[model samples]
Target: MGLFSILNYLRLKVIVTFIRLIAKWQRRRLRAAQPGPNKKQISIPSRDPGRFIEGYLYTPPETPGSPANKKKPILVNWHGSGFVVPSLGLHDVYCARVARDSGINVLDVDYRKGPEAPFPAAVHDTEDVLKWVAGQGDQFDISRVVVSGFSAGGNLALVAASVLRSSFEELKLQIPMAIAIYPVVDITVEPAQKVVPKPIRPIPAFLARIFNDSYTPNPESRKDPRVSPALADPSSFPGTVVIVTCEGDTLAPESNALAERLKDGKRKVVHKFLEDVGHGFDDFCREGSKAWEQREAAYGLIVHTINEEFGHSG
Candidate 1:
């Protein structure tokens, strides 16, 4: 590692250690305050044994319909933590709620994060999970798979879809749709510049730089299509893309830009702009609040898209 790389690594180590400590406390409180639904904790073998990936498969409660007749669709979700924290304790309630509301299998991924396994590691882990899901078609019904993510995870979702699209013919994998919630699609642009209509809580440039450095380390890596999906060809994306942007979020501009590019490329794209809310309003805001309402609306859009793709009428 070079001097800058070593410095970045050390900085990430310290920050991640502090964040993990806080995350531990947050997880305990969240678990107590908002208990998640029953989910099977399963591990997916990865090429890197040291950085094995796990996921929580949240299957909705059985309905009157028989399993043989109704094989539920799967939603593979990647949780957001700026590519540092694990998803194991962060998105429990959100993932369970998605499965419960949509009646689909929710696989909440716990992929390798930065400062330990950076850049292509998380992307590779996501691809591996998708391949594993494909192999479990009997269980997950991979014929209808939707990948969704929030913030940094959203970046991973788009990149993973692009990677899968490149190999879809050989892999026989088709990502019917994808949802990116306040995604960091362009690392090249300054976060402050990306803000539009001004944010209630603008992301600090220092923090954004930290996230970028920790995840990508090498500046040149930031230009990679996997790191910055905005740099990729619009046609490389999967069908029916949903880009959710919060008006008060510093990242909204890039998200909107990506959506516009998709539209320009004649790809089906839905752009949702939530006014007066900051980044992660969907995950952190209280229910019945305006932010929460918009968040719910976004989820409704996701469910609607899935239903439409499956040829199910409202």
Candidate 2:
């Protein structure tokens, strides 16, 4: 064969190898889900259907390295399930770490998942949680408030932040800063080739459609600014730390692109890219594991950014 023919064959083999690697990573995640004593199965109190959100609160036994006890920063977290799966009752380790290591009080918001409670519901659920935490945490020293979530949940956090900022400007109260980890910024697919590329595209897109359909009723919700945050005119977003971690060249390019846009609009923003990590990695395991290491790195960057933006003592 000519030299060019051999080069083409080698390139194809490399692409195939990358696909096999992503498949292995997906399998490892599926296996990891079944083993644990951890899921911190705590009950959310006073289950009022209207006011009751289905998640737990984690307060550190000791607020390590805290500057003062004026008010513990409230970190309201939204769980991501492609906006379909229930908050799995599986992310307790993550809740605990956010509270303990970050020295911030954490509230895992169990926003109603899709189908029965579609687009505006998850967005509303998060907004309600913020109001509740602010009102209720008067006792816990909640002088400062912030919101964070993963994937779809991160999208909720941003939408909620946008809405909350509008509320605060109208009400004259403090608008909370936000941390969005691997957030689903733009649901409109960004020209396909911009992110997914020609290879390994099918299932992720298939899974995404399946996921979106389950939670959204009106197909128009897909274009609603509240439903797809990246579609919004981000003139009034809160101080945000946009975190991105990708594996096999996965999600960060979109995240990087979003960060670029946010910066262009002059929003208070920060962005970080960790090496060789994939989506939903934080909820996978604890320390000494590769996933745990990735989660911690992402988590630490968020903490520093929060502290820097809001300051340690709120």
Candidate 3:
């Protein structure tokens, strides 16, 4: 057995303990809080090239003072679940809030989860959405497109930006900007191995192992770019906004490192950080935690970050 395997075996007890700790500390999330109302779902064309593509389009609230259709920005959002889980109901509030605050059209892409679909499926779904959005210029009057995601979705957003670079060039498509919220980039580096080191957050090792077992037991597939965007060349990054919560995040350092990498590459980057919030703090807001207000604020930061990336105040 490998050293990691041995470490994992010894750490199994600790892993169980942490899971219980997280479960006990976290209130059972009954339902996600709904944001203010906005545009309802409208059908739109998907890209010609992709496997199992799906999306729900949302528009801004129709008000007497709403922005003109041709002038509103468009946000293409990807949901987070580490490419495995698709429990996006809770995450939808963020997008809805963005639409309300920014008055931008939101395209919530329902990308496939992995294990059955695995690495390439998630990123491929994102790229396909990119194409689909580009094709929707006449429909949504989408002059400015900003890509956004949180955690795993954030990583995919960055990867999509990279993959679309060539596609943008070929199709004469505008190079859309990206907003990555606590993104898990560098798939090549195991988060369990580094961020949540074995003894510290033992559950990550267990979960990652399970993820590996489910997605691709074969070690080779885990190395694929679709599996690990961190393996992608940072020197060639697209325009980005890296939102990180410092001091209490597993992904903060890596995200900060990525921002430096983007700056080094001479690409535009907005690096924002919240000092005291933990990882996924926004989504973790329970019924009556002090963090409820903080969590509520996260959506605003997300919208502002995306609009800022596109140089639009709205």
- List pairs with backbone clashes in candidate 1: none
lDDT of each: 0.77, 0.63, 0.62
lDDT tens per residue, model 3, 143-234: 46777788778877777766445666554456457777778766555656556221222225557565444444456876765655656676
Cα lDDT of model 2 by residue, 142-169, tens digit: 4466777787888887777774557644
TM-score of 2: 0.74
Using TM-score as the measure, the top candidate is 1
lDDT of 1 by residue, 43-68 (tens): 88887666568887888766554454
Better of 2 and 3 by TM-score: 3
After TM-score superposition, the amount by which residue 23's alpha carbon in candidate 3 deviates from its true location, in angstroms, is 11
**Which candidate would rank higher by lDDT, 1 or 2?**
1
Q: Top model by lDDT, which number?
A: 1
Off by over 4 Å in 1: 26-38, 66-69, 311-314
Model 3 residue 243 CA deviation in Å: 3.0
lDDT of 1: 0.77
lDDT, candidate 3, residue 89?
47
Q: Tell me the TM-score of each prediction against the true structure.
A: 0.90, 0.74, 0.77
